[model samples]
Every structure is written in C-alpha cells, then in structure tokens.
Target: MAAVAGIWLYNKGAQHLVSLAAGALLAMALLRLLPEAQEGLVEQGLSHNSLFVFLLIGLVGFFLLEKLSLFRHNHHHEHDGHDHHHGFDKEEAGRGGWMILVGSGVHNFADGLLIAAAFLTDVRLGWLTAVSIGLHEIMHKLSDFSVLLNAGFTRVRALAYTLACGLMAVLGGVLGFYVLSGFESFVPYVLVVSASSFLYIAVADLIPQINAHKGLRAGLTQAAMLLCGVALVWLLSPAHQHSHSHEMEQHEREEPHALMWSRSVL
Candidate 1:
C-alpha cells in the first residue's frame, strides 16, 4: 500500500524526491531520534557521551560498508572491462539504497518495540502509539522509495524490498511483546545507531546527488521540498505522541482505575 504509493510518486519525480528524502532523514536523525536517545540515556543514568560515541561508530561503520560495496562493484566492472560514467556512480547509489533499508529496518523495529511496550502498559496507549507510528511510517516509506529508485532499483524490486524492510516491525513487535521489559534499556542505543545511518546516507549520498543539479529555480524547489520533508517529521514526531500519552495519564488520574480500564478494554 504505502510502498506502492511511494513507487508511484517516485515515478512522478526523482530528484525532488531525493531532496525530500534527504531532508526527512536529516530531521528524523537530528530532531527526533537523537533527542529521544539522549533523554533515554539520562533516564538510564548513562553518559550522554556514550550515545555520541555509538553514533560515531555507526557512521564510520556505514562508511566502511559503503567502501566495501564500492570495491566489489569496481572489481566486477573491471572484470567485465567496461567503463561507465554518471553524475552518481552505480555503486554509491546501491550503497545508499542498502543503507536506507538498513536504517529504516532498525527504526521500524524500534517503533514496533515501543508500540508493543505501550500496549503492554495500556491498550489505549498502545493504540495511540500504533497510530502515531503508522503515520510516521507512511512518510518514511515514501522517502525510502525515492532513494531506492535513485539507486537504480526497478519499481517492482523497490516495492518488494521496502515491504520486506517494513515487515521487520512485525518481528520486532513479537519480540517486544515477550521481552520488552528486558530489552527496554537497549532501545535508545538502537535509535542512536539508526540515526547515524540516516545521517550518513543524507550527508554522503543524497546531498551530493542533489548538488549535481544547478539552477536558481532548481535550488529553490529542492530547498522547498527539503523543508517540506522536515516539516512532515516535525508535525508527526513522537513528542506529540508523548504529550498525548501524558494527557491520557492525567485524565485517567482524574477518573477511577475501573473506569479507565473499562474504557481501555472497550
């Protein structure tokens, strides 16, 4: 569904969609994931520096991964005795595509865990968390589609791969339902690593591709699309969900537990 829509939208425009993806990834990493990870670190009495260290390691790890991808691609190209040129190399694009999938998978899995935890705590809270995640996933899927297309994936492959990545949430949900209490402490670290992946893709891959287009109108259009991407994440952020949860808790406090339980059950 969402994956199909993303493929359709990507066919409409590629470069603009890449710009938008870059923006969305940047915001999701910086504004949403990092802050959330930091807060969780505080709650766990962990040093804020530890998160940054993990973030650094994630970035370097991704860089090495890309280098390996590029090496293999170049070796294959050489073996074939063919030279190809493009604004962006196929190897780089492929690396970006894989990175997006990896990052999105981790992020979605974390979201599933959170949703499961919320449900375990209260059915109403779980529903709210699920709804919030659903909305966020739509944006993420759309952005991912754009990157996948730019990476030279066929529409069918992009849709299939994206769907496969999305399914990771189900795996996470099942695990979270059974082990959330034990796994709760690691969520923040997962988030930070995910953020690093997004950051690396956005900065190293998408931005460079975007810079290849030159013109005043193109620049303005790309900037606008990028800001729109950021705005989407800002509007659909987890902070709003947390605030809503707080309000629900406050309301439950005003009411009786039996009434709240009945409402939740209903």
Candidate 2:
C-alpha cells in the first residue's frame, strides 16, 4: 500500500499536461460550447472583481502560511541542522528531514480537501481535480521522498515515508467535500478560495524552486522554463487547445512517472 501511494504521488508531475487539458475542458464548459448547449438561460460567469478578491485572499492566506512555516516556507528559511545543497544528491535530500515530511503532510492534507470540494461540484470537475491533484502529488512525493533519502533514509525507507504521506489525500478529499458541500450558498466564495489555492501553490511552492538556481544565466533559463510551462498550460486552455480536455488526458497519459533523479517537472 505504501509503495503504491509513493508511486502514485511520484506520477503527479506527469499530470501537469493534463491539468492544462482540464483547463481547456473547463473553458469549453464555460464559453462557446456551454453557451450553445444552453437552451436559453445564460449561465453565471466569473467576475473579475471576484477573481481579484480571490487573489487577495490567496495572498493573505499564504501570508498566514508563511507565518506558520508551512508549505514553501523552506524556500526561504534554511533549516538549522540540515545541508540544503545537493538535496538528495545520491543521499537523502537534507539532514533532519523529518521537517519536510511533516510539512508535506500538511500540504497534502489541504490538497485532499480541495479535491473533495471539486468532486462535490460534479463528476467532471472531480475528475479534473483528481488529475490535477495526481500531478501535484507525484511531484510532491518525489520531492519528499528525495528529502527523506537526503536525510539518510534508504531508498526503500524513503519510499515508505512518502507513500504514507501520499495516502492522506483520500481522506482529506472526502472530508473536505463533505464539509464544503454544506456551504453551497457560498459557491462564489468557494470558487474564489479554490482559485486562490491553485495560485498559492504555483506562485509559492514552485516559483521559489526556480529562483534558487545558483547562476544568473541558470536562473534566467529556469525562469523562462517556468513561463513556458505556464504558456503551455495557457495554449492548451479550451480557447486554444481545440475545445476539449482529451488533449490533457492524452498528455497526462504520456507523462513519465520515473524521471530518474528528480521531480523537477512539478
């Protein structure tokens, strides 16, 4: 069970492509496709002001996270006892790496809740959220597992630790969905929070990893790659990716689970 969970989380990176596809599907569900399908009544649309509100909330939420030393906090603060260099370079990712395991567990728990909410919205939404989660989790596990390995855990032990952490999503998703469903009157608020969660993870968790490269040239290159990923996601959005989510599903299917040495794709 542990190994299966580890491998499942390890595959999250591969799901990024599919996330783009999911975005495309969502767009179709909103725009050209959805409009035509509606007999007469126009569906509700997202508001820019509301989006701004969500963005503000995400900023504040992450600020609290920063204060609490949660996810992405390590991108700035160094651990007192660990060597951050060559994280898991043929070794555990760092010393006293239990901190990472703990942090990751919390982060994954939040993600599980997000997944549950998405499912409660609808099956399509749930499936999309699951794939997004799967992508996020795989990269997460890869990173956490590497950290454990860097902290002197054997590969097998590291895998075990990561798998234990990975399975937390199931319970989280179910619980979150149930809890959030009771607040259906606050759909817009929920949407805002969900968007904020995505923004927080991308900006908070992933950006720092890109910024930490040693050289100026390397940093610029990484920055470019980051933009490319965003651009690719944008291109595949329903507005451009051919009005369907199949591309994302196909892309996810093609993504590699074992990237050999790292979880850089996340």
Candidate 3:
C-alpha cells in the first residue's frame, strides 16, 4: 500500500502530504499510545522495578539477537546495484534481511498490543509510552530505509516500505484492543517481551553498525546519542519510573553555559 501510494504519487505535492502524515502518525504513537501501556501495567499491579526489569530484558534480547546475527552467512552481490560497506556478501545480508524483518515485525506487532493495553488502563500512560515507542520507531524506519535503498529499491519504494512497516502499528494496536479483552491478564509479560525485542535491535544491531562507522571522534558522538536516547525515554517515563531523574537532573545542572556558538565577529 505504501509503495503504491508513494510510487504513483511521486511528485513534490504528494511528498509533502506523505511527510506530513508521517510526522502526525509518529506524534500520535508517541504522545498518545505509550503512556497508556504503562498505565495498563500499573493497573495490573506490577511493580515499577518489574517494569524496568522487563525493559532491561527487552534491550538485552535485541542486543543478543544482533550478536547472533553477526555469524550470518552471505555471498557477493550488489544491493540494488549499489556498493555498500559489505561488497562481498550480498546474499548473506539478504537472508539476514528477511530474518531482521521477521524479528522486527514480531516486535512491532507486540508494540501495538502493548500500546493499546496501556491506553485501556489510562490515557496518560498511553501518551508517554507512545512517545517512547515513536523514538524507537523513527530509528527503526531510518535503519530499514537504508537497507531497502541498498537492496536496489528506489527512494520512493523504500519510503513506501518503511511506511507500510509503520502502519503495522495500527493493525497491531487494533488486534491488541480486541483480542486482549479481559485478557489484560498478560500485559507484564507482553511489555517485557516488547521492550526486550526493541532493545535487542537497537543495542545489538543498530548501535554496533553505528559504532563501526565511527573514528575516535565518533565515539563521543555515539556515546552522547546513546545517553540522549535513554534520557529521552526516561524523561517520558511515568512518574513512578522516575528512578533516574536525579542523575539526569544533576547532569542537566552541571552543563556548561554558553553552549551555542554563533558566528565570530573577530
């Protein structure tokens, strides 16, 4: 559906509309859906530590998945006829790509279910969780886009694919809403599973690739981005999850002043 829409509507006008819709979709997911997920868990009487533990598990799982994928097999071919970092193992990446898609799809679907369950408990929790999910989604989209474009997809096709992946959130959310009726019984495990998959993909796959591209200088930038991503999620966390607030605030207070450099008059 995304490819059809983007490919057929490949004009500047359509681009504008699509981009606008993209932003709105992300905003709704972040500002609306996430907090609700948290609320749902709280209502189920799960402890804050348990929730964090699930999130931790989520991150570690993705990290491990990436590690396992490192031993992946491949043979030489041009991705979409483009020369990328791995000129030797195109077939391997292709196989790995399918695996990534499957894992990522499962993760995304779970995200949808978790978000709906959150909102069912309370709107505020839904909102916060949605925001956190949106950040991860944006990152996921960018990485996936890179893969698609490398695989010979035109820019239009890539965007469409990314968009389609994103729209799956809605489908997942709908299924969660209906299937989870009185089945709000299992949100803790669901959240744990959901968070772990996301963390794994980000930590194990994306971060390593990003870090691989770095020089000595890239290390600082990578470190900053990691902290920033974590901080942003911590910020949007429900009040009960404010365990990291003191550390974050202390860092905020210690920041050097006059950070912005303007054009030198000298």
Local distance difference test, per candidate?
0.69, 0.54, 0.53
How would you encode candidate 3's per-residue C-alpha lDDT over 1-266 as one tens digit per residue?
Answer: 33243334433333223223333333333333334445556777876566666666655665565467431111112222346664557677665555545655665666788787666655655665565566545445555555666655567766765676667778899988887767767754665564454444444444545545547766555555555555554455555354467778777766643233232332
Better of 2 and 3 by TM-score: 2
Ranking by lDDT: 1, 2, 3
When sorted by TM-score, best at the front, the candidate numbers are: 1, 2, 3
Best by TM-score: 1
Q: Which candidate gets the maximum lDDT versus the true structure?
A: 1
Query: What RMSD, rounded to one decimal, does every model reach?
Result: 9.7, 14.3, 12.5
TM-score, prediction 1: 0.58
* Candidate 1 vs 2: which has more lDDT: 1
RMSD, model 1, all Cα superposed?
A: 9.7
lDDT score for candidate 2 against the true structure? 0.54
TM-score of each: 0.58, 0.57, 0.53
User: Which scores better on TM-score, 1 or 2?
Assistant: 1
> Which residue ranges in model 1 land beyond 4 Å of their true spot?
70-169, 172-181, 240-266
Residue 23, model 3: lDDT of 34
